[model samples]
Target chain A: MCAELIFYSVVPSEEPGERAEIETFLLRNGLSYDEGIEIFVVGREGRKLVACGGLEQNIVKCVATDPLYRGEHLSLTIVDKVIHLAYERGHSHLFLYTRPNNIAFFAGCGFYPIVEVPGLVTLLENSPIGIRRYCDGLSKSRQPGARIGAAVLNANPFTRGHRYLIEKAAESCDWLHVFVVAEDASLFPYCDRFQLMKSGIEGIARVTLHPGSQYMISRATFSCYFFKEKNVAGDCFTAVDLLVFRQWIAPALGITHRFVGTEPFCRTTGKYNEDMKYWLQADLSAAKPVTVVEIPRIESHDRAISASEVRRLLGTNDFDRIAELVPQTTYDLLSSKYRMKAVGSHTSATA
Target chain B: MKIIKDAMAGTLESSDVLVKVSPSDGPLEVVVKSEVERQFGEQIRRVVADTLARLTINEGVVIVEDKGALDCTIRARLQAAVLRGGAVEGLDWSILQ
Candidate 1:
């Protein structure tokens, strides 16, 4: 039961009007309602619903809360009840689809990503005509300071380029949240990857790390909107990715200006820049377009240093070559028992 | 306290919950020791059942040590612990026939 200021009740009804709203919401989400199943939650004050997840047969679908009353863990309370009801009714498994952005919130409540259909995500991200918002931040009324976020996947090794990009984003924004992508497909585990980024950016005041666990970059990227190569060739992937970055990912993170490197030699990096330039020129009138900064590629004997280059050198067991590409500290990490072969190998090894 | 020790030994020992089946008519006892000391047996049980049902868990006993957990907090934490405890580890639903 919720306190007086908090609401605690579920209204079960077959009324046509109420059913219509629920049905409409479900239809919009491409889900259907079963006859025996019911929808319920304990609502809070200010028309804030404590939880409004649906129970179809045994599956628990769509756990949601009022944006205003988040962080209080009210949805968890209601979900607990729903889960209990499901078990008592002898249901097999609870399943629900949360926007990839909110995956961690559900993960914190013990839901794991069972299956991922990249197609469903592409459909969601590509159509930005009427899609107002894809995620609810900490607040409904956007704070001026809340307008900034850093979309980062520690992919583990934090390269100088990554450090520079994050540093630049922090300098430009009031608050920069560095999200570490949280899928297990990668070689470096989430914890190590998160630690690498956190420590790599350690003294930066505005920078904070969030686990990309279920909802962050991996989901968005796997959906092809982040990479945007579904319709286009490999050459145009960067452009499509940039469009999705601007339209879908940027808004959710409350970011207006994305800071990217101006390294034209790096294929993906260059693609991101090119796409960003196009998006800024074509679409960004209301918001500031992505700010592309040319991070002077670290040079060792006139050769430009990069993560891929470092990984290639390390693959050959060439410590000297790797040392030249990365910082002394990074060399120590790479030479250690934990020499990374994954995303952050370049950064972590060099850091 | 039929504390189902070692039931979760191999898989869940490294994780959270061990092996939770369905709650039988055996009073389904749950003992929660919290420093805050809020008497939440009835509602806690409800959350346990609800979360288990939602997760499609059939039966099990759950004993939680509360560190200032509310109703929802208790449920989420319990669900996490149970899932982590290896009850569903490596059980891929897509392959489930």
Candidate 2:
């Protein structure tokens, strides 16, 4: 039966019918087609789509095998093909999101469980000790303090509001660990955002700037953070991200508090802020709960200073207005780097 | 032979083993996940270590996912992965035995 099965790849954009076929196959298997998936490897036993798997960046999703083909091990063929595809694309470290019940199946394929949000979702990585290795590396930078504070920020261009949040968080705790979100999905790339953050938060005592990892607010942990649409499953991804932070990240550094700036403009961000409190503090069953601290957003002319507003100003080439919203370092970098490009194109600043 | 890049070989089918080799800054680390780990875990590790020793590869991460594959299959997969990983500067056809 296995020898008779044929496998093929499908690019969703190129083959809409085949993509819909895979999506329908996934739906029948209790899985939905993720919009983020780029390529899918489907196993067919004489025109019957018996098994299917997808690769979205480095993460594998929407893997399913027909119930009739249970003993044929068709899932392995799909996974093997998907993994080869990922390696060809230079993605060595791979992740998979599966149901809790399917952990053993993926584990058999050499993917170990990283984090699980109960029955909602389970994240698995190719390496068994990947999360352990990340946490171990983090332990080397572990600071000595009783009241260790932490904050995760994208800091797209590092506004004054971000500076204020860091300063306030640092003042409240003995030491502060500020992780700049490393995903390059924002208007500003990660290096620029990281540099802007480094310069913006300079001269602040007892503050350590750390680069974000997949265990942090990354695409693997929370895809919704990068997307504009409000997904119902966003809450689930948020929980998984927060859980990874609480279970592995905070424990590695002995962090006691998590800080964030108040979000008044974006409803999604504001809801995330509300969810943080529930996940980080109220829902702790055994581990020590990290206190969620929300500082009011810094205002400029009665308007809350946000990276989005700075971006909007940059689109319009309003350096004067952007200068008011962002710090000196951010303003300098933005104006110097984007001044020429902003003249002809404003689409890049739209985020 | 040094693993200069990431490479993979073999499949996840029955009686087969999938091997992935990547350059590592740390020491040579071989991770084996097999269905028969309890019975052949140590033997699998020994085969992987011996294979790396034969290739004179001292620094890399070798991951082997076995689906009831024989020792010869594991060796073949690891060799293919190492060769594909661009550790072919010094040809050692004799050591492949």
Candidate 3:
């Protein structure tokens, strides 16, 4: 017997009842509902929710179909509707996180596997040649050297500590490729942060600056919601991210060493550094392991200089303090942009 | 006609095809994924080429995901996608012949 299905788009923030129903449905299917999901497309056979799919930004997550309606193609319908919704919202590219066993199912939906963290989760993208195209682009900037090194940095405002790390890394290797995190989730916008890094490293001879892509430290690849254990989430996130770097990205650029700064603050970043060693250097069987080099963070006023310190000073309009933390280029830009706001607020306070 | 923006048409339902077109700096590139590719892969490519030729779409990346779609379904979906991708000028209906 064929079962007729109906689909409905539910925004969890707006539809509380439907959100609860979807949460229960996902749990019943052995999938946890990610709180970060922006929207969900649920398929119902009359009053019973039989299938569901979600979109968290450009990543599709928590897709499940009832065992009773396995061959009904309800999963495809839910995914199709979710894709349409994402496209309408200006998301041309999409990613999916699924278990290894379900790779064939999602592949049938046009998603090609990008990377897999064995027995944990697998990352897939809608475009079959997405990573290939990205690697091809990276190949254009490939440099030939035996001790080629790489570093990925957020560089929110290009602090002095960041310059110290890059300079130290560049001095050790024949060539150093520095990638500024492309996601604009920080206080400083991506373009401005990239410009600050470029200006700060103007005369660094052997270092090349490149923009990061979705394959690198991006929201789509760094999500920790797929793991059931909260403790392992951080490790899985680091493994997935560094695996993409070690597999597709490092080989494309001929990088043999990965450099990072000693994290004196932020426990998450510190753990990520520890996991980076295991994922990139310790795993001997996966791919050619890349050496990990950790440089001590440069200190200012007896404390480790950090971008968070600069941002905090920027909040209080303490230009003098911020000046000591960041490079001259970043300090100048911050003063020029925030000085005007500081004056405006001062005038209003007096009035 | 040129693809000025990214556009998509059709659905992933059974016996249907989903066509996605996006602007590209390179030459015309077409990628087709079908369940029956071993049996009718060349036929599907020919239909896509013929449809793009009719629409005068000589550039952009065209991706088609097929699930046992007929030849005519592929053609119609490609035309709709090309049009939606900003190939509106000089769209002579006679090309349908």
TM of each candidate vs. truth: 0.43, 0.92, 0.93
Runs in model 3 deviating more than 4 A are A1-3, A228-232, A284-286, A339-351
Error (Å) of candidate 1 at residue A77 is 33
lDDT per residue (tens digit) for residues A1-351 in model 3: 646778878999999999999999888888888988999988998899998988988999888888777764877888888888888878878999887888888877888899888887889998878898789888888888899999999887789999999999999999999998887777677898899999999888898899978988888777776555565566677788889999998898899999998887777678878888998987543678999999999898999998876766776788888888888899889888755553321100000
* lDDT (10s digit) by residue, model 1, range A159-219: 6556666777788788776666665544446676566677677777776666553233333
State which candidate has the highest lDDT.
3
Clashing pairs in 3: none
Error (Å) of candidate 1 at residue B49 is: 13
| lDDT (0 to 1) per candidate | 0.48, 0.83, 0.84
Error of 1 at A284 (Å): 8.1
Here, model 3's chain A TM-score works out at 0.93
Runs in model 1 lying further than 4 Å from the true structure: A1-134, A137-156, A183-187, A213-216, A223-249, A279-281, A284-296, A327-329, A338-351, B1-97
lDDT of 1 at A300: 61
Best by DockQ: 3
